[model samples]
Target: MQEATADTFIVRIGAVSAGTIAEDGEYPGLWGAWDQDGQFMGRHASREGVAAFLASCFIVDEQDWS
Candidate 1:
């Protein structure tokens, strides 16, 4: 876990960037989520939720490449 900027939280799996979580300006209190490719995932109530979502997405994507 690292701060992408002052406002954004970055989650990495090993050395790869998994996704990012930031305050959802439109939803207030919720966190906006985006995949590594910058695709919108959804909004989460907490950073932990966002991280779990990104990790699960990465796992599924990795399996698709196999």
Candidate 2:
């Protein structure tokens, strides 16, 4: 992950862009999520909330892999 600005970040998965998380411009203290293609995902009350959302979207489940 890289800090794009004071209120925005570029999330990555080993150099590949996963998505972005940024603060809501209209609502202070809220954050928004977007895909790498720049599609608006959703908004959250906290940065951690948005981050977890991005993780759930990008991270693949590997429990079946022995």
Highest lDDT against the true fold, candidate:
1
Those runs of model 2 whose alpha carbons end farther than 4 Å from true positions after fitting are: 60-66
- Per-residue error at 41 for model 1, in Å? 0.6
Task: State, as a TM-score between 0 and 1, how close model 1 is to the true structure.
Answer: 0.86
Checking candidate 1 for backbone clashes, the offending pairs are none
**In candidate 2, what are the lDDT values of residues 1-66, reduced to their tens digit?**
689988789877777777899988888888999988888888999887887787677766313456
Candidate 1 structure lDDT:
0.85
* Candidate that scores best on TM-score: 1
